[model samples]
Target: MNARIAPPATVALQPDAIIRHARAVIATEAEAIGALEPRIGTDFVEACRLILNCHGRVVVTGMGKSGHVARKIAATLASTGTPSFYVHPGEASHGDLGMIMPQDIVLALSYSGETDEVLFILPTLKREGIPLIAITGKPGSSLARQADVHLDGSISCEACPLGLAPTTSTTAALVLGDALAIALLEARGFTSDDFARSHPAGSLGRRLLLRISDVMHTGDDVPRVAPDVGLTTALVEMTRKHLGMTAVVDADDRLLGVFTDGDLRRALDDVGVDLRGATVTELMTRGPKTIGPDKLAAEAAQLMEKHQIHALLVVDADQRVVGALNIHDLLRARVV
Candidate 1:
């Protein structure tokens, strides 16, 4: 029987050495990102133009680590006004090639530029007359040579100490993809509202698209009292509505003033003040800050924050109370 060989002894790094290695890794990645700055030239701009002029989706394809970067690029493009989706290069040869349309642009990534799965689909892409953009480390490789536009994603060296794993190269490619997407986004003049339309379920979209009218309490739900009403009657209205405040209005429902819980506390603490006979207008804050129903709910939140108040009256152009809301309403609507 052969003697069993003992395993090599493990060498544990010191705490300082581990920290130094981590800092070196970070610095290497930062240098990789910095190296991408000069490469964002005419080729990058041309890639943006190709994608912008495409009438169909930007079909991105890659293998292995490049595939992950390609997926992120596709998502970034789609969310930033550019229509894009990723297709696995290996699957493309297995009937996924039909997903690519004539008008669509193809973005292919291959670090070595010789990935068989990606190379196999080049003829089909070329025969179909689709514009191809290649992101590769090798400028003279078959993939780059066959592409209509080539983006060089070369790196000085892999951040991996052994120089085998894709570390710096992947970072450079990902940053390049971001550069292309942002350049296209700016060129298209994609506004915040346009982005909100694409992200309606997100908080930013809610902040931008949700109007004050959508969340305000209207009709009889609003806590409102006549200006001539007594403080006790206004407090009753505020309590019954559970909005923490009440609007003091005239007979025509035009806003005259606002009375809040803070005001109620002040009224109760005043020395020798006759709360029973005092009118709401006499104690309420006059010409209080108001917002239009057409304004965004986020604007209402800002107004509330600026004045350190919790409620706001939604008025029309004619300055009549159309609705009312408090901080609780904004919170419930997820607009704050």
Candidate 2:
């Protein structure tokens, strides 16, 4: 008869044990980040200086989990005024190293400072004479020794219960990368407008880059009535344009006043005003709030909120009505 082996016994974790483990992980990671503050000295400063002066892109490379961090760091750098991109260390050996130019600087991540894939490309980096910045746990490791600048991303212990998986170490690396990017961003004097150029598809970019002219209704869509026209004609124009308001203009289309639905109601409630005889200029809100088409759509929204109105008449330098946009237009454009 064949001998049979029994399976190892399993211990189901209690709820308290699970909670305690979670707290331990959080505490360990927090302490690891806390440790980084004191270590942020010349090496971190030099990394920022090198990137700030770099004429070409910052080429980031690493292996495994560090590789993931490398990609994110590259993305952050690229988006925040520093030109950067991630190249897998393994791929670098297989002809991708050509992507690195003599003007570019290489940032290599290897927590242990001895990741083989990263090590494999070190000779190529040296051959090309590209400046190297290394992030590693071991200061004496080959990767750190070869670098022109070394950033210590060491951690006392992993958040993992086994103490083998990268948890605290990865967090430190990621945060260090962020520190570098933000420092460069500040040094470059990167503005919201500059950031918007890199991220035109994002909400913050839209808020910064989207001009009123881009979202406003122009041509025949704009609700306009001559100042001499009666409130009845202005009402018909407002209804036809479906904008709840109409701009009263002169013969030259210069904005005279704005007559909204609210003005119509007040006119009717007046004791002596006749809708058929009263002109738009008499019933309209003169010197009404106006915005230029070149202004940001966000500014338009702010004006609507502050004045308790839904629409704005877009004018030119001469205050001639050229376009109109209500909250509905902003909503349609997702700019509200």
lDDT of each prediction vs. the true structure? 0.92, 0.93
Highest TM-score model number = 1
TM-score, candidate 1, is 0.94
lDDT of 1 by residue, 169-248 (tens): 88988988898888889999999998998999999999999999999999999989998888789889999998888998
lDDT tens digits by residue: candidate 2, 1-336: 998898889988699989998999999999999999999998889888888788999999999999999999999999999999999999888999989999999999999999999999888889988899999999999999999999999999999989989999999999999999999999999999999999998888899999999999999999998878877788889999999999999999999999998998898899898777888889999999999999999999999999999999999999999999999988887777
Error of 1 at 264 (Å): 0.8
- Give model 2's TM-score versus the native structure: 0.93
Per-residue lDDT, model 1, residue 336, is: 71
How far residue 140's Cα lies from its native spot in candidate 1, in Å, is: 1.1
For each candidate, C-alpha RMSD in Å?
3.1, 3.6
Colliding pairs, model 2: none
